[model samples]
Target: MAGSRTKGSDTLRAAQMYYLQDLTMDAIARELRVSRSTVSRLLSTARETGLVQVQIRSPMDSAPELERAIRAKYRVDVHVVPVADSVNEVEVMERVCLQAARTIGPLVDSNAIIGVAWGATISAVSRHLTRKITHGSVIVQLNGAGNTQTTGITYASEIMRRFGNAYGARVEQFPVPAFFDQAETKKLMWRERSVLRILGLQERMTMAIFGVGSVDADVPSHVYSGGYLDEVDIDSLAASAVVGDVATVFFRADGSDAGIVLNERSSGPELALLRGVRRRICVVSGESKLNGLRGALAAGLATDLILDEATARSLVESDGAAEDAVGGFLPLDTASGR
Candidate 1:
């Protein structure tokens, strides 16, 4: 028994060096003081003994054709919420958020640090979140929610509170405007050590949950309709060909963020930073948000998507004949890459 265990240990070490550390078989043979063929045999022994295993991810339980198309097109894990076409906007939103809650709820576990972006859709998500027993988890506000009329605590705090309570985790409330009155003010605030602490937490985020905001949605995004932007803001977006935003950082349909001066004043993390999070779960409701969702996918913003079937169908539809023949499975025009 002891001899067999030692042999297995050597095999595992050799396999690790060759496969994981990318060492040449010659090097492994040299280090193990064995012939090249002997090194290969040990590596093969590791596989035969079940020391190495490969798992091919089975498809998730979701809309088969739609999910496959989305996975192929955007390379995102998609959950399509089937709803009747006649469902009212309010009912549709509730259903979508319920799916969001169920999808995100189980992911809450030990030591998870989740970043949350606030908005009408997020507000709906908070309400639908399922309580779970977790410890050392935290929900941090991704962006400052204060507008000119209020301090933002009443709203953004409430949202975080729900998530915190749901997961039995800590909550960190960001107290700042959704958009600063001046870009310089935001720059200066970022310099403060206290502010830097929160930014640090963001860097360590394991997961992020957010809603895509669009100006055209029938169920209006709070930021677009809630006095967060003025005539100048609207004009700037139009002038720059902006479509929608994630965490208030606006982007065009092409998912390019360059030269949009409004981003300087926006309090949200840059798309690059948001993309750094391991799992980004986005909840979307309306067809009006299609351009924004396309931009988000193009920017590599989401790893998981929770959306209604109607919206999913709209997103998959394309004008190309090949795409049509493929059942709208072609890559989104705005997508960065599959």
Candidate 2:
């Protein structure tokens, strides 16, 4: 026990020198009369033992012009991840998701209810979440994952589980189809006691996290490829001039869901419900999703956005004549108001 205490003391000292004093590993090794490799191990042990915590602030402030432009134009807070022009879309997505995970970790707290919409971007973000322990917090699925070919429980549950595990929160799964065959079926299911429980939880959500789904993404969105939609559904969306979706709810390029037809059967929360959540974090990446992102922003679905620099540049550079003509987001009844 004496030896163990001494070793822990040495590890903490090494971490302080290396992180705070900015001393090199060799310097730390010499001071402690240990080999350089041992010093490295000590530093690693410090981090593993939680004796040292590292935080990387986003570089969004570095590009003040870009960040300001996005905030001014979109009316949402933006975290613009810096990605090189050389990086592929996949790499860009990885970096942006990492930033998003870090950003979300501190915002959650005990007794907070978080709503999560499952998808490619969100799944990736889930993989990168920084563990944050909380009590009485609930991570609820914002949409169902069932489809004709598969239940989609394994895929969607895994994502929710990751978030729940990371936050030390309870998981609430929405067990239903992503899109029902008939809108009437959804209407009927919404009235069920089991479904109403989840809906009631949703109305109490304090924060919501989601990714915009786009058919044209460089990396395909899960909703478009996950067997959730059939040929008829695809044809309907295309005919309706739908650009993309927030969760499973489809919307047109002008951010209007008025005649989208498909949204009537979607299990995802309505845009109004989502907007009512105190904090809405929308994570989107890749240039292919620009149209979808534009529509989502136009709808005022997001209170904050996490996106890559290139995509942000493209978005702000555009004239946005169509979205402007559509004017601002239409007012809708809130969960309680409705």
**Highest TM-score, which number?**
2
Candidate 2 accuracy as TM-score: 0.80
Give, for candidate 2, the lowest lDDT window spanning 10 residues: 329-338
Per-prediction tally of clashes: 1, 0
lDDT of 2 at 59: 58
**Candidate 1 global TM-score:** 0.78
Stretches off by above 4 angstroms in model 1 are 1-62, 319-338
What TM-score would each prediction reach against the true structure? 0.78, 0.80
lDDT of 2 by residue, 177-290 (tens): 999989999999999999999999999999999999998899999999888888998999999988899989987766777867899999999988887889999999998999
Candidate 1: clashing pairs of residues? 298-336
